[model samples]
Target: MTEVTEAGVSKAGVDEAKAAMREIFPETPLQMNEHLSRRYGADIWLKREDLSPVRSYKIRGAFNFFRKAIAAGAKDRTFVCASAGNHAQGFAFVCRHFEVPGVVFMPVTTPQQKIDKTRMFGGKFITIRLIGDIFDQCYAAARKHVEETGGMMVPPFDDRDIIEGQATVAAEIVDQLPEGVIPDLVILPVGGGGLSSGTTGYLKDVVAPENFIFTEPEGAPSLKKSLLAGEPITLAKLDNFVDGAAVARIGDLNFAALKTFSADQVMLMPENAICVTITEMLNVEGVVLEPAGALSITVLEALGREKLAGKTVVCVVSGGNFDFERLPDVKERAMRYAGVKKYFILRLPQRPGALRDFLNLLGPDDDIARFEYLKKSARNFGSILIGIETANPENFAGLVERFETAGLGYEDITENEILANLVI
Candidate 1:
């Protein structure tokens, strides 16, 4: 198999994408962000692909795939795809736009919000099948359906046309920049690498940045692992917290363009740490971002102060299809990462004034967020789950010291998922 390099992502393909895309939606806005510029000490611009029709860049690739397939005289009028999230919504929207019949298979565990959005986009042009509890199962079912019914299977991120289509974003970035405005760095969030590969390849051909920083959720660092091993490797398990970017493996087609970049360029950020960025953007900047959307922002702290100062940087805020129902979980993770809250399992004495004694040990700034008695293991002591939130992070250390000095037997369950998910 011949390898495709960054140079191989042709400008002709991007031009074709631009021509084809205008039939669907106009180019997304690329605007300079004032808030981020002051915070990062750089001229920061956001290529607002999140403002796309499907609230993501996913639609661009999906639309391009179907258009090219139809032009190639793919006689199968029906298209089949498996995705529970953005891709499904993208595929649905494009299928409706083209008046092509589509069957989208999604995991049974997919949220109703996603399902409804996909339906709303596709309207009469698509039929949805809730097949399996997991994406692998749904993907398998969709492939089987394609084989049996002669429908074309539109993969989410692993195709040449998809890569070409996504590259249009890079073209827009280049075209939209002010005169003599060249980015020092471009930070991209990688899932299967369609967007990253496309953007990087196109920019390298036109106006390559001084550096590229590819970020992935630590729970799903497919690109980092692939670059390290010199081949794509499937993860044994994936934390679906960053569901939009939690891919098990980088797509082979996407990795082809991305292969030239050194593994050192890729950064892996913790999933919980990303929530802190998400919450901060929502509350402070009023920019509501999904977990995957906040990937570039979360890596800034680890990038050191000097690397980011006085440089023009572009951070791709990938998608904004956040489900508000998960806000509590996001808040909890943010609080924990910020060191504002902690959970402890305490063996409080069963005697009178015991609770009052423990309460007095807390600093004036510390407030109890959760308290529950497990059971009286003995007549003298009882196991209690205690959660404390403090105004200042330093207060937690002081509070812990007071507990130790008071001879209270306690275990911090904040970082223990087995105990936390069960009790807290």
Candidate 2:
């Protein structure tokens, strides 16, 4: 393995890679987001990697790896990669661009939309294999195929070449900014730490190390845990809600590049909090972001306006391959996180006019989104699972007060993960 120096990655190598990338596609935009700047009272710019051909910065790494390998006179014309999301699409697109044959292994559980997109990008240059039920299983299959066929394997984030490729994002940021204007902070979303590692590696040389803020999904804190442990540590369990950024283990190469940073510089964003940003961006700016893509922007709420006010910040919006079918779920999670929506179990007496009585307890703005009786045949009383959305969070308090006045027995299961998952 090549050693990652304390000096970080190569700036000249990244610049050269960026130059090669221009032959395939133009640099993604680095626009100052007026919506975010106004809301946070900061000069907030977004590096719109989401607008890339593959809809993510993953293409840079994939393209660079393949480009370098071909230039080095590798005999194997076939490449294999295992990915369920952005990386797969990026690899597929690059394979088509280079006119090289490639094999892509993806989890069978991956959504049809993603599968279609990957297939569309790869076209005749790639063959899609729907393998195991999870990413690990698919990755194993890809590795086995590579070993059997003596084909080159393009790892998602663990290789030095991939890291250098991703560093092009940082190079572009520096060039895109106005002369003499240095950003106070650069916020990056970490999955396996590839983007964060590469961006920070280059930015740390030009900007202060303290100016970089790394954001990871709260359910998947691979980089945060690695930083605290002083080495890489795999998580036992990870919620895949932020699918693009929910990596259980940080890549060894990527981590080596990032290990110098303090844990305080990393922020863990709640899955629901990210959903709020996704919904806000979609509704307000007409910008769609996958959960991982929203992490950098969502962490601004955690940092607060006081800390961000008058500062210039650059947030990398990593991907925009969001499935619109999940929009309702995203909105529900966002509303719940914002405290304007809740789920509860009500013990309603199984008597005539009981339902009508409960209806009167709701405030004018409070609307029942879901209501179902658990035990409809219960003689005296039955448990009713209810979901309510209100204009104001405080309206729930008044409604609960009315429920108490009516002597209705209820249990709030809004924050009860176990019960909410089971019943709600």
Q: Which 10-residue window in model 2 sums to the lowest lDDT?
A: 1-10
Candidate 1 runs further than 4 Å off: 1-8, 206-210
Highest TM-score against the true fold, candidate: 2
Please write out the lDDT profile of model 2 over residues 320-422, one tens digit for every residue: 9999999998998999999999998999998899999999888899999999879853679898999999999989889988989999999999999998989
Q: Against the unseen true structure, what C-alpha lDDT does each candidate score?
A: 0.88, 0.91
Task: Give every collision pair in model 1.
Answer: none
Lowest summed lDDT window (length 10), candidate 1: 1-10
Q: Across residues 8-116, which tens digit of lDDT does each residue of candidate 1 receive? A: 5577777778788999999988888887778778888888877898989999899899888888986357999999999999999999888889999999999999999
**Candidate number of the best lDDT:** 2
